[model samples]
Target chain A: MTTLSVRNLRTHFFTKEGVAKAVDGVDFDVAPGEILGLVGESGSGKTVTGFSILGLIDPPGRIVEGSSIRFNGEELTAARPERLRAIRGSEIAMIFQDPMMTLNPVLRVDTQMIETVQAHLKVSEADARDRARKALVQVGIPSPDERLRAYPHQFSGGMRQRVAIAIALLHKPKLIVADEPTTALDVTIQGQILFEVQRLCRESGTAMIWVTHDLAVVAGLADRIAVMYAGRIVETGRTADVIERPMHPYTKGLIGSVPSQNTRGHKLAQIPGMTPSLLRLPRGCAFKARCPIAIDQCNEMPALEEHRPGHWARCWRATG
Target chain B: MIVYIIRRLMQAALVMVVMSVLVFAGIYLIGDPVLMMISPDASELEREAVRKALHLDLPMWQQYLLFVNDALHGNFGKSFLAGQPAMGLIFERFPATLELAFASLVLSLAIGLPLGVYAGLRPHTAGSKTIMTGSILGFSLPNFWVGLMLIMVFAVLLPDLVPGWPRLPASGRGATVDVLGVKLSFLTGDGLLHLLLPAVTLSLYKGALIVRLARATAREVLPMDYVKFARAKGLSERRIVGVHVLKNIMIPIATVSGLEFGQTVAFAVVTETIFSWPGVGKLLIDSILLLDRPVVVAYLVIIVFFFVALNLVVDLLYSVLDPRVRLESRAT
Candidate 1:
């Protein structure tokens, strides 16, 4: 079953400079127990997409009127604040990139985790704390009882992320929007967290959308991958297909930018030029200005087209 | 934690010692207290007798030693005007000053926190802009002038239109029973009325300070990732701000309040003089005019001690507000 289906999602910011389309038209889905990696660079709006899924966007930046977010067949486009609050952290939860952000620094881990549980549940404080402890143990944190008494700063970065993951799993929500939960950790910690998270999804049948800029992490972890650029998905398919046969040039540039053992002592292939300011993106395909295979029709906005059964690309020049 | 407090107390003592020396020397540099204390037509013999009694005949260092020796025993000599121990006089008035300082603090926190939170929650809105502008005016105008203006409006002019509150005494420690024939004591209905204007005038600037500080800190905290995370947790706007944003901004608030409290206690001279309130600040100004060196020096020393104590309070407050600080202190 589809857990989340965001269609024509458009979030923009009205700043003094101009309207920056942070998350323009976008569409994607996550099925039960399947992990969809929303891979993009810093400004491609992957984080905004995650925030928009939870209705967490603030003022000056808004999810425009026409956007529709359907989760488990319930319309969330014009969902009231009360409805969204009821759904969030119970039916759907989000784990931020920074675990410190997930936990209040001044509060005890147990207090924070228990409160997170009680925010959506009517359980007693002791019962909530027990669930928090269990969740920590599930996330591979040992000495759950002692660790629960500590603050966020007491835990290392890796451990803190695990605590955050534990908080996300407190209710075993149907969907979790994890925005680069392991991006801040070292590689070994990253690998460990990735394995635990992937296993958690598999065992619990919880659908997840892991947003990250690290292609390597997504390549190894995600069942499916979506490559976003300039506030739109440029290419998406099975993780192996997207990695092996990148159809869009921006995807190719991203894959090439990765430092490989195969290219020892050689210069890395970098995507030339900076990302266009979201406020002043060109009046055409946003990536067309940098596309090596650009054509006259590339000046027009390209619809996301299904080039194969499950693979998709939004470039006019993409072909089998 | 005990060691930390002990260290702080020792540091406070050292600071007081250094400040006493400075204040003692500094007041003497201003003028001779004997000249101000004695009449111009006083006989030379009487002047000499007064000088000898005050130990002015001795050198400055010896006199400082004598002053310290006497001060250690809580004997700040005598207020030449009051003909009483200066330390005793200060103690008598400390409660009145404490009342004003604490009341102003309570008023500022009560008013400033909400005003600032509102200004921060909705920046650039019409109401927020008005508050910001009003706060700026509060900050710019001197308290003495504001006090006088308040007196003119409420005490001098408002009586013509209104009957009850119009008779509010503009400048006095205690109120008279003539207004509406209701007897009001220093600790009762009239007492609070007497406190209202002076406290408001005194608190206005610091209250404005608290407002701006709260607004700036709250504004900075609103965009924090943790705050955003709280919102995403399905917490209501009120809960997120009250639980997450308020606590995060509390360190700055505590620091500002502590400093402002110390300042109010030490520097309420202008407001007290304008309103003729019976506070230590009024006593200090009077002592300065009379060149009562002991009283002035003793007041300065007490203020220094207050600042040190306030510093300690602020540190403790920081630890309370942020567990991170407490953990660090424990580690040390």
Candidate 2:
């Protein structure tokens, strides 16, 4: 059973120049107590997909009709705005990159946390403060009382991100869409946050979608990995299987580009060519030009097919 | 807080000392007030007596010394024309200007803030475009011309168009009531009617200024990650705007509004002239033309003090709105 099931989801931006399809016909299911790493290059649709699940897309960008997002068996796209709002902070939560920018600089930590609690729950101010203090403790923040009274600017970068995570955990949400929440942090802090988040998800049975461009992060953190390109997922599988035996050439290229001890003192291999502009994507497999083994069969876009159990890739020619 | 206030007062005193010297020197260069006060046909002996009586015959430095001595003793001499204490004269006209400035400030904020926030929130809408265009007119039009047009429209044209419509009085403080020994026109119906025109005329420019400032600042602050985070938390749109957006934008708005209030009080000469409102601005203009040294110096010194106090208030207001500023000040 899944906490969230997205099917044929298409989020497009209608600008004056053209309709840029940011997320095109994507499908994924996140089970309770699972972490799904949505991996991509900078221009890929991972962040947009995250936003789509939250129903947080703003104007000029919209989730096209017929796209279905079901959370806990309820259709999210068809829900009223108030209903969607009701599900946002309590049932589902989001953590953004740059925690320094995410917290209001003018407000105290307690005020921000208390307001978040009050936004969904009808608790008294004292109860909300207690919840805030508890959430801070859950995130391993020391001296929660004093920290709650301090403004966001008073905290260091890592501390601020911990506070943001605390805010997300305040209601023990069932799902969290973290858009590179630790990407701006130091490597050590990143490891600490990943551990805390992994433990929190397992303990609380909450599903998470961690959107980032870093493959190494997802390799260690996510149960499954989905690699995207040009608004489509090119490959998704169990993290070990995908990392060891990537079916899609694009995923293989992505894994090759990461520097490891084996590739020490050697120039790292990279996918040749820039990420294709979504406004003017090539009319076939978006990765055809950059694919090392692209063939005539790649002239037409390939549908995702399971080449092995629980491992899927979008490519015409794939053999184990 | 006590230390802050004490420091600010000390700075104000230094500024006042410098201002007094400049004003004293500046008035000396504006020609003698005795000439303006005395009859043109007066004999030479009579002119000498008048100049000595008003201290116009003394050397500029000696005259300034006497003025400072009396000023330290809570005296600024008397107006050459009215023969009343110059400070007393200014104080009498002070209420009218204070009330007018306050009314204008209230009107501008009431009208400007919402329209500006709407424009900022939806910059592409037709309504926002229209407001932006109207603000341009408010900014570009000369104050006197706008004041005259207001008179032509509301005072002159509206009454003619609709019979039995109460025509707003064109000039003077109308039908004042005594409040705590102060004559206040706004307390009475006729006085409020008379106040409407000048107040609106003065508010238009400030209102437009506020609109542009609010719109720009709001647009800048609206997209901040905190604002988006606020939305993500499921807080209602009203709370986001009220607490997050409004509180942040209020820093710049408070500063501009405070300085604007001081400016209106001191320099609303054109509006006062068009509406013939008996305010300090009108009195200052009349005093300048008559070259009444004591009144001119007294009015300017009071304005300087007013500005100093306003700046202090704005700084305090900034601390209230933003905790970062409060924390920094406390640390110091």
Candidate 3:
């Protein structure tokens, strides 16, 4: 069953210059226990899509139009802020890139975690503390008791991110949106966090949206991958299919740009030019200007069509 | 922590010394002591005797040393105008000013903080815009003008318009009132009722400042990755704003609040004049006008002491509000 489905999500930001079409139109679904990686570069609307789903976008930026963000049959798109809040932390948790943002600087780790638990569940403070401790231990924090008493600043960057992950896991929410949670951590710590996150989600049958720019990280973790560019998803498919046989030029560029894939003596392949600004996206295909294989037919916007089973691409030439 | 405290104390001492020097210099630069004491009607012998009695014959350094030594020994000399010891006069009036300043500070925080939080949480919304506009207006208007307007409306206009529109006391504290089986005077109790006009006048600008700071700080933290994370975790808007935004914004707000509180205490001079409240601000102004050098210096010392003390308290609070700060400071 589809645990979460987002259809035609559109988000825009109103500025003095003009309205920035951040997430023009995007569609994806996360099945139960599946990990969907929403991959994109900075300002690709990946983060904006994640925020829109959570109803966390601030003013000037807004969800202009969207429909059927059905999480277990409930229309979350139209849900009130209060309703969203109740569903948040309880059913759909998110892990941020910066742990300090998750962990209150002034508050003790234990205090914040316990309060977070109690905020959703009607359990005793002691019970909440116990769950928090257990969660901390699960995240590989040594001496959970001692560490809980420590402040966010007391912990190293990696440890703080772990604590943030622990807090998200405390409620065991059905869906977790991790927006490059471990990007700031060291590679080894990142591996550990990724491992823990994957294991936790699989064990709990929790659907996750792992938004990241790192294809390698998604390659190992995500069940499916969606490549976004200029406020729209250009391609999406099963992880293996997308990685092994990338049809979209942007996805191909991204995969080829990976440092590890390059030969020892050869220079790394990088995608040419910067991402198109959302404020002034080009006519037809947003990536047409940057596409190596662009043709005259690329003047018209290509719909995201499945060229093969479970392999979607938004290029007319690719579909042909 | 001890080292930090000691360093701060040393700085405080240096500030006090500078304050004393400025005070002494200001009084000394005003004029020669002999000319001020002598009159045309007085003979040379009498004028000389008067100068000797007043210790005008001593060198400038000796006089300053004598003043400092006397001050250290809790002697502020006699007030030239009042003919009473400056120490006793200040002590008698200290509580009134302290009470007023404390009341104004509390009022400002009580109104300003929540308003700021509200304004910050909904920045572009009508409520937030209204608060922002109001605060800007409040901040720009002079305290004395506000005080006069308030007095005009509450004390005069309202009374004339409506019968028995409780006439607010123009000078001194108001009458007593009973509450919850306690006979509490407005002046002696919390002074809340009597404090309304003066407190509002004093707190208007401060409250506006707090709201502006709170809104800016809260708005900044609201969009942080952690806030989005918390929301994704299914945390409510109230929790997001109250727990996360409020706590994070507090460090900055507290800083501004402390400085503003000190400023309000210093700025109370004009408000006290308009309200006729017997606070330290009024006392200082009166002393300065009367050219009571000892009293003026003493008032400066007191004000400086309060300012430094408030700053110290704020610095200590930073550790409590942000552990990262404490740990980083300790590590450094």
Candidate 4:
């Protein structure tokens, strides 16, 4: 069953210069126990889309129109603050890139995690503490009980991120949104976190949205992948198909830019030119200026269409 | 932690010593003590007695030694004007000023913190804009003007406009009230009623400072990846502000609070003059006008001490607020 469906999401920021279409009309779904990777470069609106789904955008930046977010058939787009509060932490959890941001500097790890559990569930402090300890253990934290008493500052960067992950897993939410949760950690720790997250999701039947810019990380972990550019998804499909048989020119360029794909000592293939400003986006296809396969008709915006079974691309030439 | 405390105390001592030297030098630079005592019309015997009384006959180093020795033994000598022990005078006045300073600090925190959090959470909303504009006005207005305005509105205008409008006392301690068979005087017990106007006047400047600090700190903390993660975890906005934002914002708030506390003490001079409140500010002004050298020196020392002590407390709070700070210090 579909655990979360975000249809035609649009988010924008109002500034003195003009409106910045950060997330302009995007769609995706996460099924039970499935891992969906939303991949994009910086300012591609990937983060904004994640934030919009969570209703986390501050003023000046707002969810404009055409957003219908549903979880288990419950409409979230219009969920009241109280209802959303009830659903958050209990049914949906998110892990962030920086662990310090998750952990309060003045509060002990145990105090924070226990409070997080007690906020949603009515249980004794001891019981909440037990759950927090168990969560720390599950996330591969060493000396769980002792570590719980330690502050975020006592832990290393990697350990702090693990603690953050532990806090997110404490409630066993049905859906988790991890936005670059391990991007700031070392490779070994990142692998460990990814392993734990994947195992937990599969065992608990928890749907996850893993937003990242690292294709390799998604290649190993995500069941499906969506490639975003200039506030829209250019291509999406099963991870294997998207990586092996990329149809969109932007997707091809992204694949080409990977350093591991190049021969030893050879100059790495890089997508040239900066991402166009969302405030003054190109009149035609946002990627036309950088697309190697650009043609006369490429000047027109192309709809995201199915190129093959479960494989979608937003290029008229690709469809032909 | 102990080592850090010891280091800080040593630094504080160094500062105090430097301050004493500067204070003594400032008094000395004003004029020749011998010439002041031996005016043209003064008799030789009277001049000699005055010189002996001030220890002007001793060397500068010996005089400073005598001053420090007397200071250490809690004897600041007699005030040149009042002819009473300076230390005794300062102690008698300390409680009143301390009470006012604390009351004002509490008032500022209570009003400024919540307003700042709200403004930060919704930067461009009508409510936030209104608060921001009001705070800016509060910050720009002089404390004396605010004091006058408050007194006019509460003490003058309201009493005339309404029959039996409570008349605020011009000076002296507040009235005593009987509650639950207990005689409680605000001036002696709670101090809240007597503290109202002065606290408000003092808090206006501090409140403005705190609001700006809180807003800036909260805004910086709110966008951190963890805050978004907390929201994703389903924490309410209130929880986020109280637990997450407030805790993170404390370092900046502590700094602003400490500085403002010292500022309010200094500002109490004007506040005391306006309200005629008998606190250290009034004592300092009286001593200055009367040329009470010992009283002036003693008050300056006490003010310096309060400033130093406030900074020490703020420093200690840093470790409590961010444990990583302790860890980093230990590591170093």
Task: Please write out the lDDT profile of model 2 over residues A132-187, one tens digit for every residue.
Answer: 99999999999999999999999999999999999999989999999999999999
Q: Is candidate 1 or candidate 4 better by DockQ?
A: 1
Candidate 1: segments with Cα more than 4 A from true spot: A100-102, A261-267, B29-32, B38-40, B163-165, B175-187, B326-332
lDDT (CA) for every model shown? 0.86, 0.91, 0.82, 0.82
Tell me the lDDT of model 3 at A252: 90
Candidate whose TM-score is highest = 2
For model 2, how does the per-residue alpha-carbon lDDT over B1-332 read when each residue is reduced to its tens digit?
Answer: 87888777888889888998998898789787877878899999999999888878889999999999999998988998999999999999899999999999999999999999999999999999999999999878998998898899888998999998778888998999988878899999999999998999999998999899999999999989888888888888898998899888888999999999999999988888888888999899898899888898888889989998998888888877887785236522
Q: Could you give candidate 1's per-residue lDDT for residues B1-332 as a string of tens digits?
A: 77887877788778888887887787778888788888999999999998898788888889899988988887878876678888788877777787788888999989988999899999989999998999999889988799998988888888877676557676666743433433333466777889888989988988898899899989998887777777766777778888788887777989889988988898888888888888899888878777788888878878878787788778888878888886335522
Candidate 4: tens digits of C-alpha lDDT, residues B1-332: 67766776677667777877777767666655456335678887887888788886677678778988998897888876566899788777666676677888999899999999889888879998998899998789998999888888888898889999985654544754555543333545434656688778889978887888889888898887667666776776788788888888888888888888887775588887787766788888776655566787888887777787787788778767877665326422
Chain A vs native chain A, TM-score per candidate:
0.97, 0.99, 0.97, 0.97
- Candidate 4 residue-wise lDDT, A37-112, digit = tens: 9999999999888878778887689988668889999988898988887788778877776765667677788877
Ranking by TM-score: 2, 1, 3, 4
What's the distance in Å from true for residue A98, model 3?
A: 2.8
Model 1 residue B139 distance off true place after TM-score fit, in angstroms: 0.5
lDDT accuracy of residue A138 in candidate 4: 88
Which residue segments of model 3 deviate by more than 4 Å? Answer: A13-19, A60-66, B32-42, B175-193, B327-332
Off by over 4 Å in 2: B1-3, B326-332
Separate DockQ for every predicted complex: 0.65, 0.75, 0.65, 0.64
| DockQ, computed on Cα atoms, for candidate 3 | 0.65
